[model samples]
Target: MEFAFNEEQLMIQDSAARFLAQVSDSQAVRTAMARPEGYDPALWQRIGEELYWPALMIPERFGGLGLGFVELAILLEQSGRHLLCAPLFATTCLATPALLLASNPAVQDQWLDAIASGATATLAFAGTPGLEADNVQAVAEPTGNGYRLNGQYLQVIDGAQAQLLIVAARSPGSQGDTGISLFAVPADSPGITRHTLPTLDQTRRLARIELNDVIAGSAQLLTDAGQAWPLLRDVLLIAAIGLAAEQTGGAQQTLDLTLAYIGERHQFGRAIASFQAIKHRCADLMQQLECARSAAWYAACVAQERLDPTGDVGVASELLEAAATAQIHASEAFFTCAAESIQLHGGVGFTWEYDPHLYFKRARASEQLLGSPALHRERLAAQLLGETL
Candidate 1:
């Protein structure tokens, strides 16, 4: 596989970096985080209409840019570096993949077009941090004309403000992957309630959503009953690859921030950056960041191949391995680098005015957003042992 970015990909990366550096600076992030919606609506509109980032991975038939996952990864890395405060991750990475992988063509046309036109959406699958099949606890019962859904979803990214919600539920008494179903429902549908949760990372919003006898028509179902697990599983693998890229970017940014601070900080009539111990620590951080970046980029490449229509069927297993590896390595690298950045910055690192604390919170929060590093390691081990996940 080609590991280097082509000219077009390089241009996308450069444009994303420059745009985010100007719009999502430290003060802008703080201001957006202080809002009830957790982001600036005007800025989000500009991102969708002007930059068209949400349409990067959607097909051209759906009124999108018809780009691939690699482009999305590039944009995500830049967003993560700037600590961007928007629903782009939830909408593009989580919801868009689910829609693309669903079996219903009509549902795909409707939602994909909306998303490409700046409509934000998110997936509500797991009630907890893990994305295992059993994590879906919502119950869906078939009525005369549709399905009645009743359950609660926790830690849904951008759930409170999303215009649409792609929900996962299962038939009564269903366990594991059996009887699973996915529904694309409007966020304001009757009998639905959503509220933002207090979290360590304010830049990215998470919410608790409840469905009290919510109704979904047959047209709203993304897949037939008991057939959504396979689709959701693949969608989650894609989401994992995207998130790994973001974590890699955050790790790189933390290293860069620490290096800049150390260079300016002097003690005993000399800069602390000249010290051997400091140099060694920075070197270790760089090594970790490089490894994480490699893993993330490799996963992104595998994801693009997996999504290709003409690609080999055997690429599925490779995609799984790549995603798990990237998730494990990137999560650890980000958290470790964020912690080390705090310690290296001296007394002001933990202060409210310092940027290290924000990165630290984002690192800890994102580490558990999909699943912990330990969880990914376990999954990878199982897959390597010839066990079905």
Candidate 2:
């Protein structure tokens, strides 16, 4: 489908770019990442209150701007470009989608407002590295009052700092997607332990969470017992699209950084960018960035359509394929551009004083965050072959 940003989208994009350029510069990013929280609280508050970015896609009834996925993608792209150290991705892309997809309005009414008003949240769904049904190993046993959860979640985005934790678990003895459930547990609840994990990408923080007989009352249940896989699956697809947009932005920035370096660096009394080899390399990076950006934009459009009930629902079926395609392309593009950026910058790229290494680390980390390119390809293949995932 033909896709282009409208006037409003362009305005949002420009505004995000300008704001991030000022508040999320290289020095600001370095400062934020050095902190235990991984972001400045004041900056996060400004993002929610002044920018209203966290509420961009939430429904107006929920005290949000009631925008769509495209707008969110635009904002995320700018965030990725600036390496914004915030929980926006965890709050908006991961947890918010799960809350929005849940069938329970009570759950939505309880949490959506909090999220819109700046309460951070994250989804702790993967007990393992892969994004598959079998990865949900957390077990939830029914109690007279609510439920008792016992399990561990690894690599939860912003898990250490989020105010709310949307956890995915399954009934005892249940396997695969059946008997899956989601619970909205307070991060400070009893018997819950969170530890921030050391990561190569210091720009983003991930945590390991332990839930030991944690209580989740009935009101905290986000989905019907044993019937949350579909909702979780859709939420993951939307998140993949959002992440793909970020990767595309990172790729563009890496390419731009490389170009600037090559143009200014002198080699044999001439700019390195004037060389045929460097020109070809830059051209290839541009090609990859453009392709990745195109895939992300298309996926964003498809996602927006799927979310709109009055839109052509037929396009909704393509969401899975679009998400996988976008994820695959964007992941590869970002990694390639980041690696190339390092190489193009000579020795400084490998130094801590330079910015290329930071982007490189983020590229490698994000490629495995949601799912690897190989995993996405496998899912895409299974989807095309009509095989169960």
Candidate 3:
């Protein structure tokens, strides 16, 4: 099968790279990260209007551009390279996919429309890492006409800017994932509170969210009780593919930056890039970055095919393997490239004023955002062995 990007996808990738390069420089990202909202509203609005990146994957019937996830992945790569501090990922990659997988008609006409039309959203899926599999940290109780939710999500990306809060909460009496469901909570809902939390990657903000008896109408429910995990699994696959794409982009940027630095830095009246050892290191990083790009792109292709892992064992295994492979490779490549780039830059790379550390911090933070490389490898191994994860 052909693996190269189509003409349109290539155009999207090139245009996104150019747009981000022109507008989202390091200074712009720094300014946005320092803001309370964690992004420049004007820039976000302009991209939504001009590029429709947020609506790329939403269906045309739902007021979207009707593009595929590959297009979205292309844009995400550029976002990672520029460290664009925005709610784009929270809205497009996370919330949009959650709604799409929800398959609720009412949700489509209401919340999805707003999101496709450029509203911001943040998804609270699973509690912080290290929770027991049997543990359900958040719950929603049926209240006749609606539901009452009580729970705390310690980490939410861009919670402050999200106009919609998509929460994954379990039914009070249900066990494990069976009792879980998806709900779209208005950000201003009463009994709900959000506080920004400092993150290792300043470009991607985080927040702590608490809900105590937050009331929700039946119309607000996105998934039937106990049937949301399958949908969530699909969403996770898509997210992994998209994040892999972003990580590939970050790795590429790190390599490019390091090469430029080494070429310009002279030692003993000769450019360091000409040294054999430095060239070998750069070549190794380049190989990693290229492999990551291939893996990420292949995963995106699988996601675009709309494979249903739950329907067929072969499909499930393939999808899981593809996502795990892409995520593990991309995560390792980006972090390795970031770390080596810094070390290669010598003393200047460690300082706050220098930009490599910013990328290094992003690498370290993203390595754990979804699941670490080791975690992904463990899951992949379980699948390959035909054992439970």
Candidate 4:
């Protein structure tokens, strides 16, 4: 399949790149990340209102641009390049899908509108240090006309500022896969508490939530307990693709920055880039980045095509495979590229004052988000073998 971006998509990508480069300057990102909030609400509003980022993922009926995930992925790639400090990915990509896939129209209308209008939301998944998919442990109990949730959910991205939470909780007495139900709980619900967690990547915020008898009304359940699996899986899969795209962009930038630095910095009366070792390393990064971009773009294309209501089962498999491939390649490439970029810059790269470490921190933290390479590979292998383990 030809995977080159079309003119419109390229334009969007360029615009996003330019916008993020202007808004998320290195010093600004550093200052925002160093703050207790770990992000800039003003910057968020600027992107959401001026750039219409939050509305990009929502359907037209919800007062959004109704663009496909591929476009959003392009924007996110730019976001990663600048390490934009906003909850755009969590709210627009993760929580929006859960709300859109839920069975409650009223809930969807309310949350979707809010999200499309720049209101932030988050997905609360319970996991340990270096969390992966299938690490969730939150539980729900069926009550009269509602469900009572009690559990500790960790690493909720942007949880401290999320107005709504799209939660996946195991329901008591629910049999089989149906036992897992998704909920749209308002962040201010009684008995719900949030504690911000310290993180290496100060640009992205995380929180731990404690819920005690947190009542989820009937309107809160987005999908039937049994039917939420497919939707949740789809959401997570797309999220993986989105994150992979971001990592790919970040990797590309690191490569560019390092090569530029090497080209300008004179060593032994000549530019260091003239060295064979540096040239070979840059070539290696180029290959890795190309492979990552192909996977990410292909995944985005498949995801966009799958939006058609009549798409075949192969669409699902392709989406899974593409996302898995992108995540694995991009994660490794970003890490390698980050390390290489620092090495290429010599001692100056190691200092906190340098911008290279910021990308390094982001690359490290983002590698484990959503799911890890090991986890995604296992899932891909299972799917490829026609199993669901």
Candidate 1 residue 317 Cα shift, in angstroms, is 1.9
Query: Which tens-of-lDDT digit does each residue in 285-370 have in candidate 1?
Result: 89888888999999998888877667775787787789989999899999999999999999999999989999999999998888
Separate clash counts for every candidate: 0, 0, 0, 3
Which pairs clash (backbone N, Cα, C closer than 3 Å) in model 3? none
TM-score of each: 0.98, 0.98, 0.95, 0.95
Better of 1 and 3 by TM-score: 1
Instruction: Please give the RMSD of candidate 2 to the true structure.
Output: 1.1
Question: Candidate 2 at residue 39, lDDT?
Answer: 96
- Overall lDDT per candidate, in order of appearance: 0.92, 0.92, 0.83, 0.83
> In candidate 4, what are the lDDT values of residues 1-389, reduced to their tens digit?
78677898899989998887787888889888887777888888888788888888688888888888788888988988888888888886789767765668888888889888889998886634533334556778878878889888888889988989888787655544466778888899998999999988888999998888899887788887546767777778877888998898899889888988999999999999999988999999999999988888888877776654445746876878888898999998998999999988998998988778988988999889877788888978997899967
lDDT by residue (tens digit), candidate 3, 28-81: 878888888889999989888888888888887888887887788889898889
Candidate RMSDs in Å, in order, are: 1.1, 1.1, 2.1, 1.9
Q: Candidate 2's residue-wise lDDT over 1-389, tens digit each? A: 77888999999999999999899988999999999899999999999999899899889899989999899999999899889999999999889888877878988998888988999999998888778889998999999998899999999999999999999999999998899999998899999999999999999999999999998887888888889998788888899999999999899899999999999999899999999999999899899889999999999988888777568857756988999999999999999999999999998889988898889999999999988899899989998999977
